[model samples]
Target: MRSRSLFSLLTLVGLAALLLTACGGGGSKKKASSSSSGQAGGTLITVAKGAPSGSPDPQINYTLQEWQILIISHDGLLAFKRTSGTEGTKLVPDLATAIPKPQDGGKTYVFHIRKGIKFSDGKELKPSDVKYTFERLFKIGQSPNAGTWYNVIVGGDACVKTPSTCDLSKGVVADDAAGTVTFHL
Candidate 1:
C-alpha cells in the first residue's frame, strides 16, 4: 500500500513537471526568435555561461563547448560526420584525400593532405602545419587529454615530461613536397 501511494505521488510530480515544461511560464523577458532566409547577417545570442573556460586555442581548449565551436571552424585529417544518431559517429576524411590503411602492423598512418584547401587567412594548408599543430599541442601541455589521447605518438612520453623542449619529429613526419603527413605510433 505504501509503494502504491509513493508511485502515485511520483506520477503526480512527473505530470506537474511535464505541464510546467510545456507552459514555460515565469519571466516577462521576450524570448529571441529567428527565421531562416538562407542569408547571413543576423545575431545569434547564446547564453552559455562557464563553458569553454580557457582561450579558443585548439591545442589548449579541451572542453566540449569549445569542441562544438571549433569543429565548425576547423578541419582535421579525419573527423566524425556531423549528423544525427549513429551516422554522426562515423569517421570521415576531412583534410586527407582518403583514409589511409594502417601500415607497419597498425603502428603507422600516412595521410595525403588535400590540395587547394585554404585557411581563413587565405594561406594554403600544408602537411607541415599538421606536424606543427601536434607538436604545439604537446609543447603547450595544457589540454586535459593530451597525454591520454596523444601519448600513443612516438616521442610523446618525453613531451609529456618536458613540454618546453617537446619534439615530435619521429612521431609526426611531414613531407611538404609530397603533401603527406605520416604518424608513427
Candidate 2:
C-alpha cells in the first residue's frame, strides 16, 4: 500500500509539470504569432498637424508638412539610411545611386544620381537640383525652421552673397551633365 501511494504521488507531480510546460509553450507561440501578424501588414501613420506651407522645399520652414512632402517628393543623398520602418521609409538609395564620400581632401564630396527618378510634376531629378538645394539653404542663412545645415557644405558662405543669391544656393547641386554632384565641403 505504501509503495502504491508513493508511485501515485510521483505520477501526479510529473503530470502537473507537463501541463505547466504545455501551457507556457502555447502562450509564447500565440504571442509571437500575433506580433508577426500585426507587423506583416504595413503600418499606417497619421500626424495631427495638417499640410505644411504648401512648398515642399526643405529650405523654407522645415514644418511638419514640408518634412512629409520632402519624404514623399524629393530624394536625398542618403535617405533614412538608418531608418526604422518599412521598405519605403527604410534608409535606402534615393536620388543618389549610393552615398558618396570625399576622395581628395574630405571637402569635395560627389554623389551619383539615380537615373529615371522624376518629380511629382514629371521633371527628372538631376544632380543640379541637389546643388541648387544646398545653395538655397546657404542663401536663406537659416533652415526653414531656423536651423543651420547649409554651413556644413563647402562654399556655403561664399554662396550666400545677397538674399536672392542665397535662395539660389540653398540646396545641394544635382549636376545633370555629370550625373553627379560635388559638395565643396
Candidate 3:
C-alpha cells in the first residue's frame, strides 16, 4: 500500500513539472522565431551580472569575461586553431598572410601583412600599426602579461621601465613598401 502511494505521488509531481514546462514559454516564441529565421543579422546579446573590472580597451582588458566577447571581433598575426583536442594548439595565420620562417637564429621573425585590410574607420591597415601596437602595449603599463609574454622583444625591458618615451626602433621594424613587420628579440 505504501509503495503504491509513493508511485502515485511521483506521477502527480512529474505531471505538474511537465505542465509547468509546457506553459513556461509565455511570449518568447515569436521573438525567438523572428531572430532565428534571418530577420536579424544573427545578433548576440550578452548580459553580465556585474560591470567589467577594468577599461574596455582590448589591449587593456585581460578579464576572461570581456575576452569572450572581444575575441569574436579581434584578430592577431597568428591565432590558435579553433579545433578540439591537441590540433587546437596549432598556430594559424590571421591578419598575417602566413607565418614567416624565423631568422637570426630564431631571435627574429617577419610577418607579411594581408593586403586590403581596413579598420572600422576605413583607414588602411599598415604594417607600421603593428609596430605601434606593441609600443602602446608596454607604454600602457596596465597589461599584466606585458613582462611575462612580450618581454622577449628587444626593447621590451626598456619600454616597461619608462613607457612614455618607449622606442622600439631596434626591436620592431616595419617596412611599408614591403608590407612586413619584423620583430627582433
Query: What TM-score, computed on C-alpha atoms, does each candidate reach?
Result: 0.72, 0.55, 0.72
lDDT of 3 at 143: 68
lDDT of 1 by residue, 5-71 (tens): 3333222212111111111113344775686655678887464656447876756655677666655
Candidate 2 lDDT at 58 equals: 50
**How do these models rank on lDDT, best leading?**
1, 3, 2
Q: In candidate 1, which residue ranges exceed 4 Å CA deviation?
A: 1-52
Which 10 consecutive residues of model 1 have the lowest summed lDDT?
16-25
Candidate 2, 61-171: lDDT as tens digits: 555554554454444555554355575443344455664544554444566766766554456766665555544455555454222334444454555445445533322
Report residue 39 deviation for candidate 2 (angstroms): 21
Highest lDDT against the true fold, candidate: 1
Q: Candidate 2 — which residues are off by over 4 angstroms?
A: 1-45, 50-57, 63-69, 82-91, 140-147, 166-174
Off by over 4 Å in 3: 1-49
